[model samples]
Target chain A: MKASPMVEIKNLKKWFPMKSGFKSKSNLKAVDGVDLHIYGGETLGLVGESGCGKTTIGRTLIKIYEPTDGEFLYRGGDSSEGGVDIFSLSESKMRPFRREIQMVFQDPYASLNPRITVHDIISEGLRVHSMGKSREERKSMIAGILEKVGLRPEYMYRYPHEFSGGQRQRIGIARSMILNPGLVICDEPVSALDVSVQAQVINLLEDLKHDFGLTYLFIAHDLAVVKHICDRISVMYLGRIVETAETDQLFDNPLHPYTSGLLSSIPVPNPHMRKIGKREIVKGDIPSPVDPPETCRFVKRCPRAFDRCCKESPSLREVSDGHFVSCFLYD
Target chain B: MPKFFYKRKLDEIEEKARPVHINSYRQLVWTKFKSHKLALFGAVVLIGVAFFTLLGPLFVEVGYEDMDFSNLFSPPLTEGHPFGTDELGHDVLVRVMYGGRISLFVGFASAVITTLIGTIVGLLSGFYGGIVDRLLMRFVDVMLSIPMFPILITLTLVFGSGIMNIILVLTVFGWMGVSRLVRGLVLSIRETEYVMSARAMGVRNGRIILRHVLPNVIPIVIVSATLNMSYAILAESSLSYLGLGIQPPMPSWGNMLQRAMNYILGTTTGTNPWWLTVFPGFFIFITVLNVNFLGDGLRDALDPKFVSES
Candidate 1:
């Protein structure tokens, strides 16, 4: 592992102002004060339920949605001392950084523009960044990338609608990878694919990561898929990271109550072991993120809630080597 | 599964299956448009009419101002007067051909101007939502609320009636509908994932609007422009009928109709000059109808989901 992290997020906040009625305004704290680090050449899976600000974090990191507050520092390659804060950079100043970071979207169908051919879609980034010198050079580069992503080079001239879900996903992958970005924010890339196709895409992604030496902030809701690909995992609940550990360590000895509950919900493949395995399903709906109380976000849904869980929120603390948890039980 | 054998077989199969030519976006739209039979017919008819009117004047020797008092009220096929002569002994065929030039010019020019203004305003308003959108939409609403014909008449009267002044008046009121339509379309398109993806790629805002949003908007703008052209023609006709558009001897289709209406109740000779009114009115009707058909065809052809086979 490298001594320095490739990217470090410090106290990130993204609050969207909501209009309730006339003369009253409140903010929905979508991603409130998230602190994280993504090291070089490793997939860090961000596992969370729907609307837990997982996608928001990914978007904010790439400057898709500007952060309400905090620092997003990108330290490219081995030399880490001279990294710039992404949040403070102006749009023109940030253009070059955009070439270094790319994203694969959730929906394959919606991601590619319908009117344009696959060649145009893949070449868009190259055109913007002025990667290839000439049109023919860009065409060859696009063809090469298409083959790398497992799509035929001949498929470049076809429109997006001509392809199936899996093929379109490959095109989406090709589009992002063509830029040779250092860090890829794969925001639910496989969530919208078929169960059978998911494995293929996952393997493709894994192969590409090794081939390109790319780091990934893999945001997903599926723990099983995340465990397969991610080197380390971070469990988020309501815009806050509750636990961070190695994939096997997090799954085998889950520390936070929320993390354990998530792990238990994954169905076991063996019927014989199912009866023996205990399911610690948490109770109650996720609390509204709009002006949430200062108490622990998981207190209402925690299976082992205590007096301290309601009165005060617990910040993440290291309990074991390479494992951190936020629940008061560990404290 | 040997590498050489597998690669050779795959290459052979791919070569056999590959299409000979790749279709560009324009080619696809043209192919789809050609499939719509009615629109194709309309296009042919419109082209024929345009060519005849625009070029027919060159062949005809009779000028619009050349009045023959001796050949007054002469019906169709009467030496040198094929369609007929009007109360002023002016050749109706020459007059109709000349008038078409004015009417068609007004329609095409106004449509182009309105579409340009509407598209620019709508693109800006829709892409930059918030105060800009609210302010633009409200201004559109204010423009829409004003009575169209009354303002058109007032403006025409103020500017003095001519081809340019009438077109100017029509354009001022005409752009509002197209802007509203384009804004609605842009609002939806701006939220699409492709646009967001483009933004994430750090494609500049102007480039995104032009390359991404504008292409999607063009189909709608084209259809609306066709509709606007027909509307402009009719508006011109109505204003001229009321003696407020394209005044007198310059002979527009509208003013021609205005002059024909004077002889509808029969002239001093007790002869009904129905030929005078029928020819100009028929031209207007055909032009508008075909323009509409062309618009309908374009809408279907431009739709990305429209299957050419269907």
Candidate 2:
């Protein structure tokens, strides 16, 4: 924790304004208040159920959705500036920093520009950043990065429609990594690919991470895939981070009731274990994010919730070394 | 330093040695378009008709405005005139060919103007998607609600009837449909991941729209443009029939058709001069039909789902 963090997000909030009748407005608190740090060259997995704002956190960090409040900082490899206050910087001023941080989108089908050739799609980042001296240099760089991401060099000549789901994801990966960004936010990079191809893409990502010295904020709803690639894990519920811990530590000892419920839901493969294991399935649809209550967001859904859980909200508290949880049980 | 930053000499050498697969997206779309038999036929018809409209008049010696009182209502293959002469003794072939130029010009000019204005407005409205979208889309709705024909007639009356005025009026009314169409496309394109990824990569907003959003919308634009041209021609013809478009001494298929209307009663009497109405009316029909066919072909060829599914 003492080592200088590569990216630090402090109580970042993003609320989308919704029109409510005439002359009134409401806020959908997609990412209310989130705080986390990703160290250099580490893969931090942001995990939550489908509407829990995991994607919002990744987007907010990349400045896709401007932060509503709080400080967001990025410790650039060039340490002389200390840390750039990303949220404070104007969009024009933030442009240069964008080249240092890129994103690999979730849906490979929708990620690559279908109208463009694979070369243009992958090299678009390079062309935008004005990375190389000439178009030829960028072409060479694209070919090199394409090969690095496990695609053939000549494949760049083809359009996205010509490739399968896995090949398209590789093209998406090459695009993000082409600029050699310090932080690459992979928003469910393999969720759209086949199970067999998912492992190949995951392994390719791991290989690229080492070869490029890239740090990642991998967002996924699936715990098993997150476990395979992420070094650390942060669990989110509603619009807040309920727990954050080392991946193995969080799996071994889940502090929050929500975390335990999530872990218990993972289907055990063995027949005997499946028969004997009692699955913890929470009931009821997630409450609306519009004007959420002051109490714990998960109170109505938490199986172990008590009187105090209804009255107060829990802040993320360090229960053990590098293990943090937001439940009153931990406190 | 990471190996990707600086290109290795070996990598460059290997790049040159590798088997090159140079299949560009333009080539792919073209190849697909070529495979569509109907689209190919439509393309040929469109090109052939356009060429005839442009150059067919040059080969004929008789002027469209020249009148020969002695040759009035002459049938086809008459001396010193081909395709016969009209009731006014004007050469039907020359007038029809000349009308093609004006009709085709008005169609294309208005379509281009509409597409340009519509693309800009739609891109701005859809990409920004806030008050701008609300204002532009509402304006489109207002435009859509008005009776276009009445407004066009009123505008042409105020503006004076001429080819440019007709083009301007048609353009003013025509752009709304394209804007609405482009706006719808942009709304979806703006949400796609590549756009967000482009935004995250430090690409300027304008570049994202041009490079990512516009290219995706081009196929739709092409198809719409062809359809728009046919609509423009039809509108121009209707206006001319009402005497609000393309005045006399000038040849427009619309005005020519209006002139032909005078000869329709001749048919009831069994004395009809079929050359006047049939030839101009036939040209209008064939031109519109061919353009529409081309539009249909483009829509099929450019549909990404159609391409991938096949």
Q: By summed lDDT, which 10 consecutive residues of candidate 2 chain A come out lowest? A: A271-280
Identify the candidate with maximal TM-score: 2
lDDT per residue as tens, model 1, A148-239: 88987777777888889999999999888888888899999999999999999999999999988899999999988999999999999998
Q: List the residue pairs that clash in candidate 2.
A: none
Give the per-residue Cα lDDT of candidate 1 at B105.
95
lDDT of each: 0.86, 0.84
**Candidate 1 C-alpha lDDT tens digits along B203-302:** 9899899988998898889889998998898789888877778877778777888788888999999999988888889999999899989988898887
Query: How large a fraction of the reference contact set does each model reproduce?
Result: 0.34, 0.59
In angstroms, the error of model 2 at B109 is: 1.3
Weakest 10 consecutive residues, lDDT, candidate 2 chain B? B16-25
Which stretches of candidate 2 lie above 4 Å from their native place?
A22-24, A274-279, B6-20, B23-40, B78-81, B145-159, B267-269, B296-310
User: CAPRI verdict on model 2?
Assistant: medium
How would you encode candidate 2's per-residue C-alpha lDDT over A108-185 as one tens digit per residue? Answer: 889988877788887777777778888777877777887788887777777788889999999998888888788888
